[model samples]
Target: MQDAVYGVVSNYYQNKVKGNHEVGLIAVVHTFGSDLKWNPHIHALFTEGEIDKNNKWFKKISHIPYKYLRKSWQKLLLDIIKKNFTDIRTKRLINKLYKTHNEGFYVNAERDIINIKQASKYIGRYLARPAIAEYRITN
Candidate 1:
């Protein structure tokens, strides 16, 4: 799954990049959710603009078509998962995977923030830090 995202995003820039435009990608693959849920996702830190093969700067893409990206990611994910498990006829759990094929996946790309320092500060607080994480149960 992680590889699929890396493939799609990397390919998009590598192929779509024109003239001297290049883009560096930094992506992180996360498997769990905020409330300790099993929602898998990826977070990418992309530069605002493209850097040329000769190290020249170019204007960033004006608008990121998130819906298009999401659709692409979902297809890639489905293809990858399908290759691994192919017992849909016998395995009940495996069959459920295809059931959600029509539902489509999600890809959330945040707005490009120009301020690096402010973004780091935001991430420092927003990214989870561990501990005191005891689950309370009442009987």
Candidate 2:
């Protein structure tokens, strides 16, 4: 799951950011939401740019193309799933998902990181956050 997140972002950045294969990023998988609901998802914090062949960081990226990435992610996920599970039923479901979700899977990036404070807050909340908050536990 982690690799897939990195792969998609790396591929997109490489293609869009002038063929730079290197992408600086940190991806975290959060398996549960507040209230202890079983919700699994990945969050990534990536640099807008990276070092090019000239060994210079090209920090020109401003926005991400979520629409296109969604399609790529969907394909990647389905392929991964298909490879892991070869059962006919699973295959059928995979095919169904592909056909149904034309725009591909929905992956969300932290859009509110407008400043260092907000960014740090997000990192604290997601990246380094414990499975259960200290206050949530009681003896």
Candidate 3:
């Protein structure tokens, strides 16, 4: 799952984001949700834009559309799973999921950091945190 997420994201940025330019990304994998359940997801911190072959970085003023991202993510995930698993039942299940979700998989670009400091802080917070904090647990 982690590999799939990284692959799809990189592909999206490389191909769709800004033509054929390269994009930098830092992916963090979270295997558990706030409820301490197995909810695998990727927290990827990426450059605001892409870097050209001339070694110049270009900052994008606009964000990628969520709809397009979601669909692309879904397709990539399914393709990865299909390549990895050859079981007919699993393949059928994946196909069913693809068919059931018209909007594709969820790919959210939650928040954007305005500067390098903010980006560093955001990364630090997530990296330093645990799967579920003790403060969030209540009876």
User: Who wins the TM-score comparison?
Assistant: 2
lDDT of each: 0.63, 0.80, 0.76
lDDT of 1 at 107: 68
Q: What alpha-carbon RMSD in Å does predicted model 2 have with respect to the real structure?
A: 2.1
TM-score of each: 0.66, 0.84, 0.80
Task: Kindly report which residue stretches of model 1 are placed more than 4 angstroms away from their true locations once superposed.
Answer: 14-16, 19-21, 86-103, 122-139
* Model 3: per-residue Cα lDDT over 27-49, one tens digit each: 78888877789988777877767
Cα RMSDs, all models: 4.4, 2.1, 3.0
lDDT assessment of candidate 3:
0.76
lDDT of 1: 0.63
Candidate 2 lDDT over 1-139, as tens digits, reads 8788878878877776666448777788889888688988788887777876688877767777788779988988888999999999999999999899989998775463568897787777788877798998898
Model 1: lDDT of residue 124:
60
Q: In lDDT terms, how accurate is model 2? A: 0.80
Please say which candidate is ahead in lDDT: 1 or 2: 2
Clash number for each model: 0, 0, 0
TM-score of 2: 0.84
> Better model by TM-score, 1 or 2?
2
